[model samples]
Target: MTPISKKLSWVAAVGLLASGCAETPKELVDARAAYKRVSTGPAAKTNPVQVADAKRSLDQAEEACFSCWDTSAGRDKAYVALRKAEYADALSRNAMAGKDLEAGDVQLASLQKEYLSGVNARVAAENAAAAAALGTLGKTQAQLDADRAAAAAAQARAQAALDKIRGKLTQDERGTVITLPGALLFPTGKGNLTAGGKRNLDPLMEFLRTDPRKILIEGFTDSTGKAAFNQKLSQDRADTVMNDMIKYGNIPADKISAQGMGSQNPIGDNKTAEGRQLNRRVEIILLKPTN
Candidate 1:
């Protein structure tokens, strides 16, 4: 070939190479770097299949750039490749973290077992020492008997006090509950206590003033109106009762609470007038002492 012709061909080749290099998308570059990092790191050993999938995606990106001459397609495939590499790396990290967590859990369980053993040993020693002291004193049995008698007397007194108050009294898991009909407490669709309502509550309030039991006043409504209106009305009535107990009954504020159980826990069918009357009632719950 002539010298000039050879030189021209070389120049054209250099230009093509420069253009190809310049046109390499940023996504492809980033994907190549990510794949290199993941493939050479721990992910390659722990998640080889994921690494291989990333490699295939990278290959497709390269193919799109060179063969298809589509920069957008190439970028999409490269992004997929980058995400796959990152996912593989994340999986490896998560697996390692899980192993660490499992090891930590095993260590914690061993520590707890050792602590419990020590605690049990100490408790047993204390019990044995107490038993010996009790045997020497000769009063442990007598003290226990006295405590049982006192507890029984106290329970009887409490029951007697509960019986003295006049209302529909019942015992349940929540303690002694006194149900007062809504019609007796307030005018229809109103929160203010009626004159008779105040009188009706006087006995219960007097009992609460003497007894130091915690009180929970729950106001309920029948399904006669919009639920929202009923809920607000019930809440207002409960709050008013709670305020009265605190203000007039001289009950400690901290020992009393109130809530509106809007149209819930119906004791009677809502369809009937009698049932609805029963459903719309306020309950005064005398909570049992926790101590």
Candidate 2:
């Protein structure tokens, strides 16, 4: 061979070797990039164990690429390494988010504790101020004891008076209530008081005259009638009872008021006759003294 042709053949061989050495599969390149990204990111700190696993997978892929005879084997290993790196990164981010959530919960708990403490402090301060004001008003411990005794005596007297009255007597937040049956007081669908009703109310009037307590007369009816009719009838009956107490029972008009409850606040099952009878009633509430 000629000298020039020999030199050209040697140069061509060198070029081919360089080209083969420089060429790398796309999967391997992608895997190397993914591993580097995860190792350098928060995954390095938050998920060190997973990041180490990802590094090992990348090393295996590099070994496969350099030593394995088959290109597909190298590619498959590279794909696995890429997936491991991505999983590590995802896990790291999730762990970081969980930590942030934990921190927020701690802060929220602290805020709630602070709020409760503030409320307790305010309430204690208010109580202290009220006690001081009471002291300034010349309310000694002896005076306070006397006031409590007086209040207890008043309650006992009211209870004793209520026990003497007939009808279903109940005590609630509104005061003492006496429920009188509508059947005994009036004929069905009528507003006028029956003879038995007048007799029943006579005791109530005498009690009121003696007790001198403020009163409210409320009328209720069963669900058998139309709502409008029931409402009007209840109002008329309440008014009639109030007028009778003022005229005959000698109760002060200024101390008594009347209202119609209609079919509201049923005392029993409306479907049964006994329940309906129980529902139709008049309620006289003896209000607590303003003192």
Please list the residue runs of candidate 1 whose C-alpha ends up more than 4 Å from where it truly belongs after superposition: 1-166
lDDT of each model, Cα atoms only? 0.85, 0.84
User: Could you tell me which 10 consecutive residues in candidate 2 have the lowest summed lDDT?
Assistant: 157-166
Candidate 2, residues 1-291: lDDT per residue as tens digits?
899999999999998775664467788899999999999999999888888988888888787776535667778888998999999999988999999999999999999999999999999999999989878676677788877786566556545544544467778888878888888788899898988778667766766755556899999999987999999889888987898899989998999999998999999899999999999999889887877
lDDT string for model 1 (161-270, tens) is 44553347678988878787888889999998988788767666666765557899999999999999999888988988899889888899999999998898999999
The reply for model 2, stretches above 4 Å from the true place, is 1-166, 289-291
Give the deviation of candidate 2 from the true structure as CA RMSD.
Answer: 20.8
Could you tally the backbone clashes for each prediction? 0, 0
